[model samples]
Target: MKKLLAECLGTFTLVFAGTGAIVINAATHGSITHVGIALVFGLVVLAMIHTFGDVSGAHLNPAVTLAFAAARRLPWREAPGYVVAQVAGAFAASLLLHFLFPQDTTLGATLPLGSDAQSFVLELVLSAILMLTILSVSTGAKEKGITAAITIGGVIALEALFAGPISGASMNPARSLAPAFISGHLSHLWLYLTAPILGALLAVPLCLCVRDSTCCCASPTSGKS
Candidate 1:
């Protein structure tokens, strides 16, 4: 129960702070700027990982949680609860944003600025890189400690800096889903739903290549997963 609550709270904070930057920026005519928004996302993730990481492994993103399970870091039985908590927290944040920004349509939802395929491919790569950094720096399923914080945050910042204009640099399903559902921008939702998970799963095999066999497999103390 504590783990579930940690996930929920971590996800809520992430969605709220990150997307809230977009909403405020749009409302204020980009005062936050693209760079500022990217930094907000990176910093928020860092803070959350440090805050709730030990409790829930800070799997605020469903793709991360699912990928951990796929890589055998997290148990399959617990994946559903993690995903549910993440989605629920996202919904809560989006609803609140909708209430606050009734005039805006996207509610900071991730929309493809280019063709669906283009955005789909971009999101896939972004998620892959992000998850790869995560798995490499993390211990087991836990994204605790300084190295995990800096690397994960740095990746998010870099991805958002380069890809936000083209693909929204989502790399996060729950983050993309809440605003889309709340704001009724579901036309390209399938890409977000599929790409991040696929990319994250793809990182599992890649991890095995760059890391020792023990690092990517399942074992309590063998650094597998």
Candidate 2:
């Protein structure tokens, strides 16, 4: 219960602050550029991780939660509830942002449908990288190095640089879904969900394939003496 609530609020913060920056930037002539938008998204994730990380692991994206499940870091039973909470919180934040900034049509939303396939493919690939990096940095094996925060933020900034102009670089399903509904634009919703989820799912196997078996706990063998 507390964990779910934390996940909800954390996700809401990510979309609200990050996309809200988009709305504000678009409304102003030169106040904030693409770089600024990317910064907002990255910084929001950084702050939120430090905020709700200890409680809920700050998984603001369904894709992320699913990835953790796939990696066996999170129990499968808890995923559905976490995803629901995250989506609800995101949509609520979107509604608030819409109410606050009615003049900004973009509202820091994801890219529209019919965008070039070249860009879409890039978004998908980069999104996968983002998920993979998140899993790697946040896992118990690596979190001990105090690199989780920095690594996740760095990956976000790097992916944003790659995908910001193309498909809005959204590796987060909840972040994309809320604004789409609030703005009444369902364009490319599939890409936003499919690409990120697929990317995140792919990370599970990819991480396992590269993980050092020696670092993991050894199993007891009955026949061994």
Candidate 3:
């Protein structure tokens, strides 16, 4: 229960601060700016990891939780609980955002700036990179501590900065889902849900390349969990 609460609150805070930046920037007529919004996402992730990483690995993103499970660092049985917590937290944040800024159309929902295929590809690449970084920095079964936080946060920041104009750089399904769901802007929701999971899963094989094969493909009894 403590772990679940930690995961929920961490995810809630992540969506609140990160998506809040987007809503605020729009409300204030770009006062936060694109770079500032990206910074908010990164900083919030850093803060959350520092806050809850020890308890639940700070997996605020469902794709991330799934990726860890795929890499055998987490148990499959635990994945659903984490994903549910993350989605719940994200919806909580989205509902609050809707109440706070009702007039905003998208409510920070990510939409493709160009073709849907382009956004799909970008999201896949972005999530793959993000998951790869998470796996690389994580120590043992934990994705916590200073190094993990900074490196993962940095990767998110960089991805958002470079790709926000194109695909909104949403590497997390929950991040994209909450706002799209509440705002009725779910036209491209499928891309987000499928791309990120595929991208995160793709990182598993990549991890095997640089690290010991056991590090990424461990079984339940291989000491990963």
- Model-by-model lDDT, in order? 0.90, 0.76, 0.89
Q: Residue 11, candidate 2: how far off, in angstroms?
A: 0.8
Least well predicted 10-residue stretch by lDDT in candidate 3: 216-225
| Per-candidate TM-score against the hidden true structure | 0.96, 0.89, 0.96
Query: Which pairs in model 1 have colliding backbones?
Result: none
lDDT of 3 by residue, 116-168 (tens): 99999999999999998999888555774588899999999999999999999
Over 1-225, each residue of candidate 2 has an lDDT whose tens digit, in order, gives 877898899899989988888888877875988788788788888887877777777788899888776666676778898899999999989899989988777666688434657555766687778877876676531232346766787788778876677678888889988898778777667778788888888776776677765222233221210
Error of 1 at 206 (Å): 0.2
TM-score ranking from best candidate downward: 1, 3, 2
Off by over 4 Å in 1: 220-225
Error of 1 at 84 (Å): 0.1
- lDDT, candidate 1, at 208: 94
Steric overlap count per candidate: 0, 0, 0
Q: Residue 102: error of model 1 in Å?
A: 1.0
Residue pairs of candidate 2 with colliding backbone atoms: none
Backbone clashes in model 3, listed as residue pairs: none
Tell me the lDDT of candidate 3.
0.89
| TM-score-best of 2 and 3 | 3
Q: How do these models rank on lDDT, best leading?
A: 1, 3, 2
Model 2 CA lDDT for position 106: 61
